[model samples]
Target: MLIHRIFQVVTVIDCVVGMMASGFIVSVGSTDWMRRRKLPACDRILICLCSSRLLLQGTILHATLFPELTQWNVVRGHSVLLVLASTACLWFAACLSVFYCLKIATFTQPCFLLMKLRISAMVPQLLLGSALISLVSSLPFLWVDYSSHLCNSTRSHLKNISFESPTGNNISYFKGFVMYVTWAVVPLLFFIASSTLLIASLWKHIKQMRQNATGFKDSKTEAHITAIKSLISFLMLYICSFIAEILLGIPSCQAMSRWKHNICSLLIAVCPSVHSILLVLLNVRLKLAVKSILLYMKCHRKQDSAEALWQERKSMSSS
Candidate 1:
């Protein structure tokens, strides 16, 4: 148990660092790059997603540090809303990937169809999808209380976690299974399948375009590939998380086991960090923004040193 607590502490620290990095990336990357590009506003959407993810990470981190909140107690109603918001962000990101893939692949038929749909129409759909999933996933929590030791909606508690019926008035098992299917299994499948197909389609298109010596603009193709790689990285992170979740759910698996906990804890942090890397490494506008931020930092440091020197001279004169 002491070892488990230590692991949780480490995981929390990592999550905090990742969240901070993501915040910086979003502030610097979104306004500087996404807004400038006049692209379909995907990067800003991702920034919002990452921010929600960061909030989820913080909730988990607080739970790990305090430990007394238990599974059912840790995530409040608003936390559930944030989690649902995160899911919405992720779905929007998947849509962003699909839009990007179509944009790059020059699938004129589908592109025309997609263009006919307004961004406003799409936002409500994604939000509704997220809301339904959250509602279903959280149904089990309504039966349990803050004191229950069982893994309610959030999968944190193990020993004191209530699995059996509390008052025999509730269907805990049924609800738990629903939560898993709605939140984990189904969403995981969609994330994996959609991202995989998008990548494959982009790959084929890029190869065909290359072979045909098609008049497809080279710079545009390269930009599409960059976005593709970033999306692939995001999807792969989700896949890792899905696998970790499955491993954690196995009956034979020890809930407090180091490996299960470690992987699960790490995913909480790693997912957002991957987004930060993509923004800085893949997007040219983000890279420039980072460069500008660095330059500003250097200049600020130099000014601080100059101020210190002036203060020292003034002190010497007073002496």
Candidate 2:
């Protein structure tokens, strides 16, 4: 019981931090859009990605931390909605990866050049298409008979398990498998493909620069390194999240100790939030914005302390 409580506290902290980072992205992007009356393509994508992640993290916290409240039929019916938010977050992040690859990678091929030229114009359309795809993919979940397999052997052993059984009827299993593949596996493939291409392009560029006697101590080289690091970090987190999700769905995992289940849930919740913080760190403008906000808060705090001290001194003298 103590271990379970510790895990729950850790999960809550992870969710809170993730929500704050994602919320920062949304706030900064929206503020910029409002001031300029237009948002860059990348900022637009960031906004969508952060918004989706925020919603996803919020729902995950509510569902995980308070399973009893979510057990109502009406709340359970909205399982598809949670799936929709998660799908959107995954697709948007994948889209952002592709956007970075197209924008930053230098490819001399006509097709690659053409895509680089047109990607800005295509961002809105791509986002819309992703949204439509997420919606379509999630809709099938609504038709899934969640109540049909309530007495499944795996779930019977678990306390407060929310996911429907994927080992039930042949039809339900097939649908669940399809949904899992489309929602999780496909987006991961896209992210991996984009990250690979970006890394290859950056490596080739770095090599050519090195051959030209330009040592690798320049801003562009540093940027390339940062981007590569960011991609690697995101991939690592995504893999962890993927494995956790898979394990959570397994019957064996359902029978695990409460602390083990809590740890799995914590990993699942960490992915979106941590990835958003990485995004902020990798992006120059976002990094600057976060720094500025922190500096402002620090200065304000000092000013408040100074004022309090002055008031105390003045009161002591008068007395």
Candidate 3:
């Protein structure tokens, strides 16, 4: 019970932080898009990714804060939507990685050149396709037997923090495994392929640049390094989340008694939260926006302090 309470608090804090970060990204991107009257393809993907993350974390927050929401009918619907949001997030990430690779990776293949030329134009279709795939993956929940297998809340100990159980209904281990394979795993594979290609291209470019007599890093090298860092971080966090989700989807695991499975859910909750902040930092536009915001806050605080000090001195002189 104590461990459950602790994990619950941690999960809540993680969700809150994630929501704030995701919200910041959405606000910044929306503001830029509206001001410019145009949206870049990369910005489009990032905004969509953050939006999906917002929905995903919000749903988790709703379930955790309101335990009774996991009762029966509500839980099944929530579970369906939750998985959908997660799948969308995964797909969006894959799209983002692919976009970065195509835009940054130096490739001479005819297919690669063709994709690079058209990737920007294809973003909208890619996003739509990802959403459709997620919808398809989620359809199984609606088809499953919710009356008996899913609605049985009696088996749940911790308001059923995990979506599925062993009975294989609205929620089962076998179904969860299948969904992960069909939905999450596919995007992960795509992401890996793109990231690998990007890395190889970056390495080759760096080696060529180093061969120059100067032997000094230039803007291109720095850009390559940054891209590699961003891609590596994304890969690491995504893999952590993938593993965590598989643990949470297990049916037989008791969240209360089995800290392993329970903690994995917490990991899943934390991933988006942590990664949202990371994305903001690694992105040039987002990073600049954050710096300006921080500067403004600092100046505002100083102005407030100066005003308070003036008022205090005036009062003293009057006295």
Query: Which candidate gets the maximum lDDT versus the true structure?
Result: 3
Q: Model 2 Cα displacement at 234 (Å)?
A: 1.1
Please give the lDDT score at residue 178 for candidate 3. Answer: 73
Off by over 4 Å in 1: 1-6, 25-40, 75-90, 108-121, 124-136, 144-169, 212-217, 250-258, 317-319
Judged by lDDT relative to the true structure, which candidate is superior, 1 or 2? 2
lDDT by residue (72-152, candidate 3, tens digit) is: 467667778888899999999999999999999999999999999999999999999998998888877764533332323
Which candidate achieves the best TM-score against the true structure?
3
Task: State each candidate's clash count.
Answer: 4, 0, 1
Q: What TM-score, over all chains together, does every model reach?
A: 0.74, 0.86, 0.87
* Candidate 2: tens digits of C-alpha lDDT, residues 176-220: 645756577888899999999999999998888788865447787
The sequence of per-residue lDDT tens digits that candidate 1 reaches over residues 1-319 is: 6877678777777777767766776676466565577523565555655666666666666656775543333434433543454454455455555545444544456654575355535644654565466555555554433333234334455434443333443444334434554665555565566566667767877787879895668876677678778877877776675565455544433463656666676675566666666767777766777788899999999999999999999999999
Q: Report each candidate's C-alpha RMSD, comma-separated, in the order given.
A: 5.1, 3.8, 3.9
* Superposition error at 179 for model 1 (Å): 2.9
**Full ranking by lDDT:** 3, 2, 1
Clashing residue pairs found in predicted model 3: 165-251
Output the worst ten-in-a-row residue range by lDDT, candidate 1.
144-153
The candidate with the higher TM-score, 1 or 2, is 2
